[model samples]
Target: MDHNNMITKFDESKYLISMAPVEKVLEAGYYLNLNDQSNVLDLCCGYGEMLKLWGEAYGINGKGVDICDEFIKKGNERLEQSNLNHKIDLVCQDVKEFKTDEQYDVACLIGEVIFGDVSGTIQALDPFLKEGGKIVIGEPYYKQKDVPQALIEFEGDLLTLEGLYDTFKRSGYYVSYMAGCTDNEWERYISWSARRDLEWLRSHPKDKGFDNKEKWIDTWYKMYFNYRRPYEGWALFILEKI
Candidate 1:
């Protein structure tokens, strides 16, 4: 018997922009008792993928805040095409300056939360969430002990999984559920990143980093497979305010 956990690969790449796959994203959404009335705020919503997933699956009304104009414009355009136009919206604004008196039922800090590590992120988003509200965070953590000093320095904000859970607890939040990024998902992200970076180098031959881009990519892959992949991992965490 194959005792190992099963890996599910998606044919399409719509939700493949991040380390977390579509199923995991959906699972995170299902953790919330959302309805049409439930408001979700995504603090660093890249292209608003999580918002779109939750809105479609759980009938959530979402507001996404992203600093990228392109991300907001594209996300809003996509929202306009579907019934979600009224249900979801994306704003291009610095998360720190986003002022709203409306406390959300769910607040997300997916990919990279601006305030830094897990503890700081929780503190930053706390004001936006209603009492006992949920926070869905996509973050990286040390998967194994004995991480190299170089890697430890590189991933300055990351803590071990146990450390992260402990931090969550100390911050007055209950870790409801966590969905890890599969090995396949990490590979998929690495491959996509390589392709994207190489394409940029090809288009900008005279760019300052063009010549060293290949070396950078090679080093990145080496670091990923040899060090980061085994030692570090990303996960979508469901944290409920306690």
Candidate 2:
């Protein structure tokens, strides 16, 4: 596969423009009994967007951690720009290795799971939760089978909804509720992302080593963006530690 081209196209277009899903998810989480005294940890919190949204609306003290330095940096910058920097903390650290001196009332692992080495990933974050704490996980169910096709194609370890819930259960966590997003979420996501990505590619022509921008664009629209089974939509599993 043309990794460079693929990365360039996806990052430049899909990543740059997508925001509705995060907003919608935060809206959903906000109504779930969050409060001012709540100490929240946003696992895999890319750019702290969710943290900012929830923190501002709910008065929750939020801290975010992501494996990507760029994400951490951008998150900090956005928090500062919003004048909520005092309430938000950003950490650039690997999720599997980062340790916290404090526990949180609520924790989130939103849309950033990449599938490999997940057992360790689950174990690492499990300790950060306070007793009976809540954890909100976001995942896609783009296929009907036990495994999602996107996961297999990307060499990702696909965890079924039952499997993930089971992992939490064996760890003494139980599901509180599960919500299915609208199909519009997925459609809007692809549409926005594809547009943003094209702009990013224009500005970052040489960043990802893509020599043929046209071919990159073609592959993205043809295979990557156009792929994926129609499901309405992603699943949000709200789990509570026992």
Q: What tens digits encode model 1's per-residue C-alpha lDDT throughout 42-113?
A: 987867877887777788998999898977887887677657979898999999899999999899887774
Give the per-residue lDDT of model 2 (tens digit) for 1-242. 99996774444333322334554555656645777788889878877877776776787888888888987898798789878888889899977666769998777776555434434445656778888677777765434444445546743545556666667678676777776656565555655656656877778877765556656656555553445434213577677754
How does each model score on TM-score? 0.89, 0.75
Give lDDT: candidate 1, residue 29: 72
Can you tell me which runs of candidate 2 are displaced by over 4 Å? 1-24, 114-119, 146-151, 155-157, 204-208, 212-217, 224-226, 231-233
**Which pairs clash in the backbone of model 2?**
12-197, 13-193, 13-196, 13-197, 13-198, 14-193
For each candidate, the alpha-carbon lDDT, in order, equals 0.81, 0.66
**Where in model 1 is the C-alpha error above 4 Å?**
1-12
Against the true structure, whose TM-score is highest? 1
